[model samples]
Target: MTTDAIASSFAQYVTESPTAFHAAAVARDQLVAAGFTELSELDAWPTEAGAYVVVRDGAVIAWRLPESATATTPFRILGAHTDSPGFRIKPNPGVRTGGWEQLNVEVYGGALLSTWFDRDLRIAGRVVDADGAVRLVSTDAVARIPNLAIHLDRGVNDGKEIDRQRHTLPVVGIDAAFGGTDVLDWLRGRVGEAVSWDLFLADTQAPARIGIDGAFLASGRMDNLTSVHAGLRGIIEAPADGDHVPVFAAFDHEEIGSSTPSGAGGPFLEDVLGRVQEGLGATRSEAARAFRASWLLSSDAGHLVHPNQPEKHDPTNRPRPGAGPLLKISANQRYMTEAKGEAVWAAACDAAGVTWQPFVNVNTIPGGSTIGPIAATRLGIPTIDIGVGLLSMHSVRELVHVDDLAALHGAVAAFLAG
Candidate 1:
């Protein structure tokens, strides 16, 4: 696909996926459109050659098995996370103070708190009603966290600290009756019924093509969503007739250490892969052998060289947007990309006619982790951490070179097809 086409599709994915559950739903739709059958975890497996998808809450695993596939066929898993840093509404969120109504929120991860102030924000997530039906809701901007004016805090120009509990509450309205059931009432109105659910606050602004010539993409949820979309598109577009089985796995809750039932640290991936192997009549030893030959690409967003703060990145391994997909590495094993894994990614890049750059955090600065290390350790599979370089990660909105997405798409497709 052209760079514009790739960027446009990614923007659409980001716009539609404000939460992990929604992202998995969108991935499910894409896989179904590509003729993949949905499988329930409780169902018995069929020993057949077909494309199938298994879902667990906000996580999804889609794979294509050819007729020639056997118990010992190696699996090529493309990994990405569906979650991002944001604010989730508290179960009892409504509060009244000074005659104004606000919602209590809990911070989900390491979010840039300052960027959230004075922006149009909306609530989106899955809502389960009284009758046990789940509904996805993405409402327009109905709340905002107004920052303290400069007149009230003259020291604001200087770096200011924000208390997560006290300072970040978003003001919803001036109604004093909004204390008890106000937030839920508003959501129920939008959902067309009374329902109990979990909700997250998101920026209402749509994704946009920025820069002078529309060279950059500015959007929220790009950190991992970019990888999610790229991997989904790559897996769908890759040739599926190869001996190695191709799998697309996107897990939720990576932003918060991936410890949930559907997170990478859980049994979702292992269970599905085990089922695939078992269906093929593989012994445990043979399955281990297959894992030894298997490889995974844990795709997430990497940091681009920031012009305003270049000192934060490693001087020797600075990554730039449009250079290519960034191969993330760390001596501390924060990233799963070791020398052998690097070699596999390099070959994929060469096959796809794409160049690549390396990303390493400066010695003084610590870096974050991804599902790469978690799944690699869990499954004992050789894995490399890969991503497109972007700026303002975890902020209300992030930026990435438009063409970088296309390069990432090419590299992932080549890796899956290789």
Candidate 2:
């Protein structure tokens, strides 16, 4: 597909995915539409060559098996996360102070809290009803966290510290009569007696192309969603005749250190891979050998050299947007990329005719890590970290080059094709 077409489709995907649950569900629907059969964890899987997908809560894993595949055939996996940094609604979320009703929320991850001020925000996530049914729920713009007036705090132009507990509550409504309103009641009205929920607050703005000649794309949750979309497109467009199995695994809770059941640090990927090997009639030793031969491309967003804060990036190996995707490196094992893994990614990019650059942090400023090291430790598979460059990575709205976004899809497709 053309770069413009890819950008357009990605914008729609980001708009439709406000929470991790929505992201997983959207990916499942797209895979099913592409002739991939959905599987249940309790049911027996087919060993014959075909396309299959399975979803576990907010995580989804899909794979395509080749006709030449065997019990010991290796896998080429592309990994990413579905969750982003934001605020999650607390239980008994309704709060009233001086006649104003607000929603109590807890900070979920490392968020740029200032950007969330005065934005149109909505609540989105999964809800469990009394009948033991799980339903996805998304609401319109119904709440906002308005910033203090400049006149009231003239020093706000300087570096002002924000209190997560006292300053981050979002106003949702006001008491209309003697009785007060509860946010849970409003949610129950929509989803029918929701007994429990895993809801989060998200920006309601649509993703769009901005900057000169539409050179840039801006959207929320692009930190990892960009990689998720690239992997989805890569697996769908890859040839079915490759020698190895191609797998796409997007897990949740990466923002909070991926320790949950559906996170990369958990056993979700290992369990599925073991079951797949079992379906292929593999012995225990053969399964171990297959894992040893497998490779994982841990795809996540990387930082670009900021025009204003150039000193924060490595001077010699500075990466920029629109040039290409990034191959992240860290000497402290923060990233899983090594000499052998670098060669594997270089070959993939060369085979796809795509350009890429190296990304490293400055000596003074340490960079954040991705799911690469965690997954590598868990599965003991050779892994490499790679992604598109972006600015404002953890903000409510993030920015990325349109060309880099499309090139990432090509590189991931090449990697998945082995």
The most accurate candidate by lDDT is 2
Worst 10 residues of 1 by lDDT: 175-184
Q: For candidate 1, write residues 149-214 as lDDT tens digits.
A: 999999999989999999999988765563444665676688776467778999989999988888
Compose the digit string of candidate 2's lDDT tens values, residues 1-418: 8999999999999999999999999999999999999999899889888999999999999999888888899999999999999999998888777777889999988999999999999999999988888999999998899899999999999979999998999998885344666766776787677889999999999998999799999999998999999999988887788878899999999999999999999999999898888888899889888888999999999999999999999989989888889999999989989999999999999988889999988989888999999999999889999999999999999999999998898899999988
Residue runs of model 1 more than 4 Å from their true location after superposition: 178-181, 192-195
Model 2 quality (TM-score): 0.98
lDDT of each: 0.89, 0.92
Please tell me which predicted candidate would have the highest TM-score against the true structure.
Answer: 2
* Candidate 2 residue spans exceeding 4 A from truth: 176-180
Q: How many residue pairs clash in each candidate?
A: 0, 0
Cα error, residue 48 of model 2, in Å, equals: 1.6
